[model samples]
Target: MGTRHRDEGVTMAERPLVVPNPNDPRLTRRLKGLDQDRQPVLSDVVVERPLTLYLNGQEIVTMMTIGDYPECLAVGYLLNQNMLLAGDRISGIDYDEEVETVVVRTERVTNYEQKLSRKVLTSGCAQGTLFGDVLEKFREVKLDRTAVLHTRWLKTLLREIGTLPSLYLVAGAIHGCALCAGDAVILYMEDVGRHNAVDKIAGYMFLNGIAPHDKIFYTTGRLTSEMVIKTVQMQIPILISRSGVTAWGVELAERAGLTLIGRARGRRFLVLAGSERVIFDADAGEDAGA
Candidate 1:
């Protein structure tokens, strides 16, 4: 999540609000700008709103979100939390922007209490947290070890998906998450919070009946514990990003047997876990860094 400041001397109406721009040139630009001082300013204001997930008129979880795609976030959060068995279970979602809340209607009351009770706090910029023992469960996930991805295909996927339309492109202060199958980017989402973006993608995937195992997850944000857990929950074996990863995230990915590739800039990348899935070019020689 982004941050904003209001001077005590200035009134709230008079203060300048800085918002986040996920598409800032500094991070997304193909070429660095010559006039560094004249760079475009991205907003830093983190959009905060409450999302209420309801099952048969009973409230399940009231989440504090960055509020962009409320429906997707609600559904995705439920899916990640293991409260949702299938996308068809969600009957409807109603948003009340005036009250800053979203109401989700589901077919059945999913048993989410156990998962919710295991919340583990983290040190993320936002109020980032996760459910405990979730990482341990990932250890049981058996992936197809020989599912090789070519270096050329990886580059193509990144380049093509990187140019796709996003909330970051419009707001400049958001994070983007996408699902790529084969050479096509099937879904893309952006939000003021990285978690929200991931949730949106997850929700879309769920609603569309897209199997996670055959797809690769991509993001323009840091690979944190929540990010790793979300990917694991989706059963997506491969995750690629242009950002860095946390120690715990790397550990979880390794235990979950996921192929995590980070720092995917241009022709280079770092595979923090499940290196066997990434097949380097023969012409690049055996010296190619993993």
Candidate 2:
């Protein structure tokens, strides 16, 4: 099917698949006496589909993702890779489900040169690969603004945001990614692969005229180099997670001058980079120690 952009622009609710009632009567009664009843169970039905991203007619990369929001995933992937400058740069996106490929048509083909230069293959489940010197590219990132995150605000945002529609809540086999402006979550997405979730958010942002310079990104997954690059590509200043950050992830965040917060739960979180953007009260410091 040909890619169709929303006439009124894209909305967060339009991109991610939603499950109306996660605590359905059937599952609720079925798990009444189970110890892990409240925990999201992993489903074996999740299958990986190959999504080939074509930039301006030139084939980019083939990513394995849960087959939802194929157009958003493709556009977002290109945006994250810095292969796209603006929403208008993309002429169209064609998703051929029969052949399982996504062809992205762009107005200018020159932007993808850097990404097509050198490819490094990795052993990641999502067909992870990096083009050119990823570390060096991150070093040149110039963030537009910084987000000052308070402990209370972080706690409130996470709690409020977690209640939104998510694939993990329904299928119990996906990761979620969100874009927040202060305590308000503007975008949220879920996918069997965390990268796809982030990519979906990126795609929605691109199509909706949302600039990442003034936003905070949150994830229910580990902060890796790929994740870090995605945030950097959006020019987002802060990234918070209920997980851990890899050494490379931390290094990239520091180099890009982005704030990295991990293990964000309750009232405490570890700030790995850009501590200046976090505002903590003196009393909270004492409470953390106590």
Candidate 3:
């Protein structure tokens, strides 16, 4: 994972919302190094571990992660891959730290031998993999046309997300994904791979009974096809990112009725898809003049 730092899971008590726990022991390792002059230097390197995921009795995939929120990652990966359906009832999620493996059991027996056969290597860090069925489901999803994004909320979301304490700020080598309602960030998740962060957010939403139609999905990484697909799978109408986007990502967003906002730095953003949903309600000098 090219990160000098890692994103961990935990909530900061001082902040009213959930943020990454940069202080966690398992997420980083202290190291001694030397500069060009051979001077002694100390640094914290983010740790990556292999976690194997099992759905029922079949092995799904093993992912490289920062080792926080294993259950979320497992469930999210299954959900995003189309192995787990929205109507499925999860009976239990069992994790074994000794082996770094998680097993998700559901009331419904599942099998995905065919879906697992075809895999596409994605641009996601830590070798993000996507199954073929994901796109099939993508075409079938119909997002809420009534969902909208206000400029004021977008501005506020940018400010709050930046100020929150995160492992990315502390360690330096992680990506983040946030689930927001209006200007409020409902949850913040981070990991070595942008895919993992997104998956964690998805898993958290499924586990918590959170609805996605009226929410905004924000990420520190670029808007890629994988990102677009995952957001559509979650059924979120507005996807905002401070980073840039890919042509394919924009195309997918357009096809899925997603309001994709990118290059959202400072007070400017480019809405490449679903522009009809923007309300442009922010005031002048702090606004997008509607």
* Predicted structure with the largest lDDT when compared to the true one: 3
Could you give the candidate ranking by TM-score, starting with the highest? 3, 2, 1
Counting clashing residue pairs in each candidate, in order, gives 12, 0, 1
TM-score of candidate 2 to 2 decimals: 0.77
**Per-model RMSD to reference:** 12.5, 6.5, 6.5
Error of 1 at 228 (Å): 1.4
Q: Higher-TM-score candidate among 2 and 3? A: 3
lDDT of 1 by residue, 1-290 (tens): 01112122432233222223445442233433335588755543334556666654556666666565666777787666666654345667787767766666666655565666788775544565666655665566676565566676677777777677554554466677877765556677766567777878877666645556666888888888778888888788888889999998999888888889999987878999988888777246453333
TM-scores for all predictions? 0.74, 0.77, 0.91
Candidate 2 shows a clash count of 0
Better of 2 and 3 by lDDT: 3
| Candidate closest to the true structure, highest TM-score | 3
lDDT of 3 by residue, 176-288 (tens): 99998777898899999999999998887787666777889999999999999999998989999999999999999999999999999878999999999998877744443
Assess candidate 3 and give its TM-score to the true structure: 0.91
Please list the C-alpha lDDT of all candidates, in the order they appear.
Answer: 0.67, 0.72, 0.86
The local distance difference test score of model 1 is 0.67
